[model samples]
Target: MRHQTYGKLAVLAFALVLVSFVILGFTRAIVGFRTARLLAAPTTLLAASLVCLLFVRGLLAWSGLRPLE
Candidate 1:
């Protein structure tokens, strides 16, 4: 149960990263380098969050918590 929840949360986090990356890319392209760099903050944050979630999920799986099963 916990593993499943964590898996879902990880997936959500990854989705957020994807969305943020797209937004950052578009903003950077449409705006200038300075503005794009500013927008990168959130995208970077989302990426970090996604990585954390994936790490957590991996730990859980290693502990015998099969979320995908």
Candidate 2:
């Protein structure tokens, strides 16, 4: 099946996952960013990325199911 079959929200969710990874890389590359609060950016991005991935995957899976009602 084509990805479009999953719906637009799924597409947006996947894009968010990609963008999060890109931002995560940039945050990790910054110099002198060891302060506690500044250090949390990458960790937060990772968590957000995981959630987006799970949401997209769940949408795809749900789209493939058929209800008997």
Candidate 3:
């Protein structure tokens, strides 16, 4: 049950991140902010956060750390 819950939460979090990235990309494109300097920070932060979350979740699973009931 705990593993199932964590898996669901991880999927939800990933979906949210993907949605956010699409929104950010569309906004930047519409606003004509094509330059890397203008759009790098937020994109980088979002990507980093996603990566960190995945890493943490993977580590937890690998180390046999179950989610809270």
Candidate 4:
């Protein structure tokens, strides 16, 4: 159950990253670099969050705290 939740969260995180890029591209085209840079903050934070989640999941699996089965 926990692993499944993690998997779903990971996918959601990836989707968010993709959406962020689309937003960034649109803003860069319509507004400017400054606005795009400001918008990038959330994307960067989401990327970091995703990395942390993956790292914790890996550690749990490695330590046998959360087995694949």
TM-score, every prediction: 0.62, 0.42, 0.47, 0.76
* Tens-digit per-residue lDDT, 20-43, candidate 1: 778778988799878876877776
Report the lDDT tens digits of candidate 2 across residue range 25-44.
Answer: 66667744454336556555
Candidate 3: tens digits of C-alpha lDDT, residues 1-69: 466766776676677666656766776866765553355556556656766776787777678794444
User: In model 4, what lDDT does residue 4 have?
Assistant: 84
Model 4 steric clash pairs = none
Winner on TM-score (2 vs 3): 3
Q: For each candidate, what is the lDDT? A: 0.74, 0.57, 0.64, 0.81
Segments of candidate 2 deviating more than 4 angstroms: 1-34, 65-69
Q: Clashes in model 3: which pairs?
A: none
Q: What residue pairs clash in candidate 2, if any at all? A: none
Candidate ranking under TM-score, highest first, comes to 4, 1, 3, 2
lDDT of 4 by residue, 42-68 (tens): 986887798797878778888988865
Off by over 4 Å in 3: 34-54, 57-61, 64-69
Worst 10 residues of 1 by lDDT: 1-10
Candidate 1 error regions (>4 Å):
60-69
Candidate 2 versus truth, CA RMSD in Å, comes to 6.3
